[model samples]
Target: MAKFKYIDHGQGGAPACMTLAEREWEQPAGRQVLIQVAYAGINRPDCLQRAGAYPPPPGASPYLGLEVAGRIVAIGPDVRGRKVGDEVCALTPGGGYAEYALADERHCLPVPKGMDLLAAACVPENYFTVWTNVFDRARLAKGEKFLVHGGSSGIGLTAIQLAHAFGAEVWTTVGNEEKAQACRKAGADHVILYKEQDFEDAIKAGTGKQGVDVILDMVGGDYINRNIRSLAVNGRLVQIAFLQGSKAQIDATPIMVKRLNFTGSTLRPRSDEDKGLIAQALAEKVVPLMEQGKCLPVIHKVFPLAEAAQAHALMESSQHIGKIALKVQE
Candidate 1:
């Protein structure tokens, strides 16, 4: 029997909880494909789960990863177009830390040409997120102004590059000058040092007091209303995470006056159908960009699968410029 290595959970900090262990995995069931995982992407939610701050979705695995790239080794009867020996990158509910994992067939996407498993592993979470929030939720149109918080983060960096390639004028907020420069190189039209200046003021000045047409925010707290103030008439605000506390004292006057729209979503709980729609859209719209070298994940570092805790630590330091991934194969 082939054995699988997985990140087992205990209690306390990342290293303690992110312990690696050997296990025997069950066969894939309905529409599920068994993947011999080559690489897995480390996400902030994984760290939160390790810290006991976030919980796995009901009925999902308790392991600590969401996205992976690998080869299909087995498939349930209902799975299609995915066969043994096929290479794919996928969005999973959990369990991606394992050497062998299962994924919904619809959620699996072909690894783009010229991209290896490590680079492809970084795509699903951030790519699916940015595609849904920026294009579907915010409906960001070409030539419009877009502002994203935490620009140097995985999701933010993906959003910036995608928005830029699609003809949007992208603006972003970052903590330091180095991150600001990184944002600029990633195609942001303007970079705001959120620590040195109020982003709302900077946005106002940058847009000649007109403000951005769309705002993608992960930092909540005072950012809730500040996001409102930063929008132009009919602007849309798409919130994905609350890195800061979600609570806030907000004045709704600006929202009402500007006719702004506020919406947010978490990807993990969505039905397979919803994510499948996003996958199809990305295949048609974004994969070509990857093939053309116009868009790709900026990998900051790669860690062995056993060192997931250390990877989480690096992500927490906010020192990495873009994505952090795990090399699960060797």
Candidate 2:
């Protein structure tokens, strides 16, 4: 057996728990492909996993990292549609922090034409997540009003660009003026400085009290009720994370009266078939936009693979305006 270097977060604690370590490499099996990773994306879930909050699903790799962009060096007997030397950015089940990683062929998307591997590495997690939650689940249509919280995040920026590209009125909430500018440049129609104004109130006033048609939210704590209140009569609210906390006490009367739908999902635990469907959708609809430069991943910073701990620390600090990545090879 061969060996490879990876970040190990033994027993899981803080960002400092992650360290460069070695493990024996395993051959790709079934539909998996062995990637000589060039870069791996850093996401909020990665930080949560490192802090012992999120755990990998059954049969998934235990290491941190959920997305990577690299070349297929080997393929399993069952693999199809991908071959050795194909350049792809993949949504990995786990272990993306390694010099080598295994990804299901179905979860891989070609690096968009004219895009670098570093930018491609930032795509899988945020794009797959936004595609599923905002489009597939929330059904955001052209001319509809959409609001996403955490406007400066990779997920937030992805949502802003996609919704705008699809002809929706995009709104977002950010922590400061710089983040507000980033969101605006990403195609946001309105940017609310959460530190200075109330998001629910802003939405109400901005839309003439009609509220938004769809809301993609990650701030769960008290924002749950505010999200509910910010929806139009037949609106949908998609909750993807709980940055503040999950539990909330809210009025249920509005849900009944307004006929609003509240739903959400995490990408990692989804079935492979479901993920494949999303990948197909992205390749068909979103990839063209990438090729046209209409919407693309916004990378904020990159760190060497050994500095994954520093990457996580930067993520948890919430200072970055877009995606962070780790350079795994060269």
The C-alpha lDDT values of all candidates are: 0.91, 0.95
In the range 63-90, model 2's lDDT, one tens digit per residue, is 9999999999999999979999999999
Residue runs of model 1 more than 4 Å from their true location after superposition: none
Candidate 1 shows a clash count of 0
- Candidate 1, clashing residue pairs? none
lDDT of 1 at 180: 88
Q: Top lDDT: which candidate number?
A: 2
- Residue 247 error, candidate 1, Å: 1.1
What is the Cα-based TM-score of model 1?
Answer: 0.98
lDDT of model 1 at position 327: 91
